[model samples]
Target chain A: MISQLGDGFLALAQPLSFLHLVGGFLLGLVFGAIPGLTATLAIALLLPFTFGMDVADALIMVAGIYMAGIYSGSITGITLNIPGAPSGAITTLDGHALMKRGEGTQALGMSALSSAIGGLVGVVILVALAQPISALALQFQTPDKFSLVLLAVVTVTIVASGPLIKAVVAMALGLMISTVGIDPMVPVGRFDFGSYHLVEGISLLPAVIGLFAVCELIAQSSIPASLGKAVAVATIDRPRRRDFLPSREKIREVGLFTFLKSAIIGVLIGMLPGGGASMASFIAYAEAKRGSRHPEAFGQGSYEGLAASESANNAMCGGAVIPLLTMGIPGDAVTAIIFGVLLIHGLVPGPALLGENFHVIAPMFAALFMASIFIFLSMMAFGPVYLRLSQINRGFLYAFIAMISMVGVYASSYSLFQMWMALAIGVLAFLLRTFGYPVVPTLMGIILGPYLEEFLRRSLIVSEGDPTIFLRSPASLVLLGLTLLFVWLLRIRPAVKRGRAEAAS
Target chain B: MTRLLRGQVVFALGLAALNTVYASQLLQMDRPFANGEPGPAFLPLILCGFMYVASIIIVVGEFRTAAAARESAPQSDVISRIALIGPALTISATALFIVTFFYFGYLVSAAVFTFIVSLFFNYEKSGDLKRSSLIALITAFTVTLFGWLFFVKLFGLYLPVWEL
Candidate 1:
C-alpha cells in the first residue's frame, strides 16, 4: 500500500502535473468569482476541450478546478455578499460583515486559508478511506441505492423553507422535468414532440446553467437594490507590496480549528446525498457560534466566524467524492459534472474500479492533495489581485457581464438557439429573483433531477413499477419516514410556530 | 397591497399555473406499460399532484398574510405602481429582442434593444448621445469581440454575423 502511494506521489510531482493543478485552480477561481459562472459550469464547458487530452491529466484538471471552485466562491460571498456559487451562500453572512467592518482582507485571508486546510484534510481522508468505503458500498444493491437517494430527497424536503406541501411540489417539478424525452426501457422518445433536440430530453447542464445563472440575472434586475452596491476591491496585497495581507496570525488562529471541525462535518454530510458543503458550512457556522467562547462575535464578522463556513464548505468536497467514485453516486453538483467528465473519459465508476485500478485510484487521491496545495499557494499569490476585480465599476461590470454571457453561451455551441435560450433564462431568473422565489433549488433541480429520475425508473424496473418496492426496502422506508418527519419539522412545524407566536404576541 | 408583493404573488401564481398545465398534459398522455405496471406517467402523476397541493398552499399563505396587513395598515406609500413598469418593460424588451433578432438580424435587434432599455437606465443620460453613443459604441464593440473573437475564433462556434 505504501509503495503504491509513493508511486502515486511521484506521478503527481511531474512538472506538468503540478502545472495542470495550478491551471485548474486559477481557472476554477475565475469561474467561481463570476456571478453567472460556477464550478460545475466551468467543468462542463471545459469538457469538450479535454476530448483529446490524457485521461489522468484531464482528471487532475477537473479535480483542481472542483476544489478551487468551491474555495473561490467565498471570495465573492465575503467581499460582495453575492455568493459566487450556491455553496458559498453561507459565507456571505459573516464574511461580508467582516468586509463591512473593513476586515475584508482578514476575512479573505481566513476564508482562503481555512478552505485550503479543509480541502487538504478532505483529500487525506479520501486517500485513507475511499477504498474501504467503496468496499462497504459493494454491500448495497438497487434497494440500498434507492434508499440512499430517498434519504437525500428527504433532506432537501426538510431544509426547504416553504410549506412542506410546496417544497414537495417543487421537488416533483424537478422529477417531472427529468422524465421528459425518452424512457430508458423502451429507449424510444416519449415527450420529444418530434424535435431532434427534444428527443435528447432537456440537457441537464444547460438547464442548470439557465435556472441558476440566467434566471438569477433576471431576478436581480427586478429587485430594488437594498444592499449597497457590491464592494469594490480596495487594496491589492502582494508580499512585495505588503509583507502579507490577511494577517497570518489571524489566519492561523481561524484556519486550524475551523478546518478540523469542517472536515468531520463534511465527511459526515458527504456520506449523505442531500447534504453537501453548503449545509456543512451552515451547520458548522451555527455550531461554531454555539460553542464559541466569543459567541456574541458571530454575525458581526468575527474571524473565526468566516473560518467556520469556509473550512466546512471546502471539506465537503472530499466527503462528497467518497460516495461518488466508490458507489457511483454523485455527492453534489460538482461531483455530478465530474461524473459526466468520467463518462467522457470512458471510466466506469463503482466497486469494480476500486478493486482493479490502484494505478488510477492512488494518483487520483494524491492529485486531490496536490491540487489543494497548488490552489492555496496560487491564491495567496494571485488572490489579492482579485480584490481589484470585485471593484470593477457597475456599468463596466454589467457591460462586461453581458459580453461574457454572449460569448460563453454562443461559444460552447454555435447554435444561436442556445444563446437565445441562455439569455431568456437569465432574464427569467432575474425576474424570479425580483419576486422572492428562491433560485438555488431551481439549479439544484436541473442538476439532480436526471439522477433522481434515473434511480426512480430503475427502481420501477426492479419492482414492476410497484410502489410497495420502495416501502419494502428498509433503507427506502426509513428514508420515506424521514422525509415525512422532515416535512413536519421544516415546513409544517415552522408555520405552526409562527402562527402560535403571532397569536401570543 | 405592496406593489412588489403583488408582483410576487402574480409571478408565483403564473409559475404554478405553468407547471400544472404542462405536467398534467404529460401525465395524461403517457400510456401505461403492457404488463399492468406503472409507466412513465407515474412520476408525472406524482409531480402534478404535489404541484396542485403546493400551489394552493402558497396562494393561501399569501392571501392570509395580505389580509392581515390590510386590517392594520393605513394607505400605502406607493410612489407609483408604474415604477414597476421599468423592470417589466426592460424584461419585455429583452424577450422581444430575442424574438426579433432571429426574425430580423443581430444589428437591428441590438440597435432596438439598446435604444429601448436605455430608457430604463437613464433616458436623460442617453440624451447625452455623447455618453449614450459612447456606451452604445462600447456595447457594439463588446458584442463584436465576444461574438467573433471569443465565440468564433477561439471556440469554432458561429454567431449570426449581421455585417450588412
Candidate 2:
C-alpha cells in the first residue's frame, strides 16, 4: 500500500498530470466562485472530453476540480451573500456577515484555511479507513442496502430546512420522476404517458442542469437588481497577501478542536451514500453553533462558524470518495459523474477496483491532497479578486450560464428532447422553490429512489414477500434503528421540545 | 378566501389531482398489489398514495397557518403585478430559446437566448436599453464563440451550428 502511495505521488509528479491538476483546480475555482455555476457543471462540461483522455489523468483532473470547487463555493458567499453552491449557503450565514463588517479578506482567509484542514483530514481518513469501510460495506445484503438508502433518503428530508411535510412531498415528487422509465426489475415501462421520449425517462445530467443552472437563471430574473446594489455600496479595503492569512488570534478563537470535529463530521457524512457537501457543512455548522461558547456570535460574523462549515464541506470531498472507490455507490452528483468517467475507461469502482488498479488510482488520491493545498494557495493568489467576483456584469454571467446549461445538456446526450426535459424540470423546480419547497431533497429522492425500490423489491423476492425480512437481517435492523434515531434527533425531539417550551411560556 | 386559498394551496391540490391520476393508471397496470409478488406498479402506487396524503396535509397546514396569521395580525395583502411579470418574461424567454434551439441550432439559438436574457436582467438593473443592448450584444457573441470553441473545436461534442 505504501509502495502504491509512493507510485501515486510519483505519477502526479509527472509534468502533464500536474498541468491537468492545475487546469482543473483553476476551472473548479472559477465555477465555484461564480454564482449559478458549480463544480458539477464544470465536470459535466468536461465529461465529453474525458473520452479522449487517459483514466488516471481524468481522475486526477476530477479530484482537482472536486476539491477546489467545494472550497470555492464560499467565495461569492463571503463577498455577495449569494453562495456559489448550496454547500456554501451555511458558510454564507457568517461569511457574508463578516463581509458586511468589512472583514471580507479575513473571512475568506479563515474559510480557505478551514477548508484545507478539513480536506486534508478527510483525505487522511479516506486513505486510512477506505479499505476497512469497504470490507464492512461488502458484508451488507440487499435488505441492508435498502435500509441504508432509506436512512439517506429520510435523513436528507429531515435535514432539509422548511416544513417537513413539504420536504417529504419534494422527495416523493423526485421518486415519482425516477419511476418514469422502464421498471428495473421487470423491464416493463411504468409511466411513459404515450410519448416515446418519456420511455427514456429523465437523465441525471439534464435534471441537475435544469434544477440548479436553469432554475438559477429564472430565480435571478425574478429578483430586482436593486437588491444587489447594497453589496457594491460596501466600502472594501485593499489588503496585502499576508492579510489573506487567518490571524493567529482568530485561529486561536476558532480553535483546532472545532476544525477537527467539523472535519470528522464531514468525513462521516461523506461516507454515506447521498450525503453530499451541503449536508456535511450544514450539520457541522449547526453543531458548531450548538457547542459554541459564544453562540450568539454565530450568525454575526463568527470566525468559528465560517471555519466549521468550510472544514466540513471540504472534508466531505475525502469522505464522498470512500463509498465510490470502495463500493460503486456515488454519494452525490459530482461523484456520480466520476463514476461515468471510470466506466468510460473500463475501470469499475468496486472492491476489485482497489486491488486491481491501486497504481492507477493513486494519483487521484495525490491530486485530492494537492488540491487541498491549492485551496490555501488560491486564497493568497485571488483573495482580493474574489471580492470583485460579485460585481461581474449580471448580463454576461446569466447569459454565459444559460448558454452552457442548455448547450451542455444537448452536447452530452445529442438529444434535443433532453434539452427540453431540462427546461421542463427547471420550470418545475423554479415553481417548487418559489412555493417554499427545498429542492435538494427532491434531487436526493431522484438519485436514491431507484435503489430504494430495487433493494426493497429484491429483498421481498428473496423472502417470498415477507416484510419481516428487513428486521430479520441484523445490519438492516441496525440501519433502520439509525434512521429512527435520526428522525428523533432531527425531527420529533425538536418538535416536542418546541411544543413544551411554548406551553411553559 | 382568496388569501386563504393561496398559490401553495392550489399547488397542493394540483399535485393531489396528478397523484390521483397516477394511482388510477397504477390500478390499470398488471397486478399492482403485493399479494403474490410486488409487481412493477406496486412501488409507484405506494408513492402515488403517499403523495396524495402528503399533498392533503400541505393544503390543511397552509390553511391552518393562514387562518392563525389572519387572526393574529392583518398586513397589507397586495402583491405587485410587476413582480410576477419578471419571472413570466424569464420563463417565456427560456421556453422561446428551447424552441429556437431546435429550429436554429446552437449558434443562433444561444446567441438569441443570451441576448434576450441579458436584456431582461440588464433592463431590470439599469432600465437603460442603450447599455443593456451593448452588453447583451457583446455577451451573446463572446459566449457563443466560447461554446463553439470549447464544445465543438476542443472537445468534439456534436453541437450543430445551423439546422433546417
Best by lDDT: 2
Q: Residue B29 lDDT in model 1?
A: 57
Which residue runs does candidate 1 get wrong by more than 4 Å? Answer: A1-20, A31-62, A76-107, A161-166, A194-196, A223-258, A343-368, A383-386, A395-434, A443-466, A474-505, B1-9, B12-34, B67-129, B139-143, B156-164
lDDT per residue (tens digit) for residues A426-502 in model 2: 88888888777988677777767888899988998888888999999999999999999989987999999999999
User: Candidate 2's residue-wise lDDT over B14-94, tens digit each?
Assistant: 888878766766755787444577878878978987997888788888877875534211211221343567668777877
How far does residue A194 in candidate 1 sit from its true spot (Å)? Answer: 4.2
Task: Pick out the ten consecutive residues of candidate 2 chain B with the lowest summed lDDT.
Answer: B71-80
What TM-score does model 2 score on chain A? 0.88
lDDT of 1 by residue, A1-505 (tens): 6678787778778888767666887788887776555787667556544544566777778888888888888878876778887778888888888777766766776777778788888887877788897787677667666666666665664565544554455556556656667775556666555667667766544554555444533443343332324545334334242332568677665656666886678667766655767788888888888777788888877778777887787778888888778876665666766665666667766666667666766666777777677655765687567565454323333333443444345445545666665665555555554544444454445545655656777777778767587888776676678767766865678789999999999
* Candidate 2 runs further than 4 Å off: A14-16, A35-58, A80-104, A232-237, A247-255, A272-305, A327-361, B2-5, B33-35, B67-82
TM-scores of the candidates in the order shown: 0.79, 0.90
Q: With candidate 1 superimposed using the best TM-score fit, by how many Å does residue A409's alpha carbon deviate from the native?
A: 4.9
The window of 10 residues in a row where model 1 chain A has the poorest summed lDDT is: A235-244
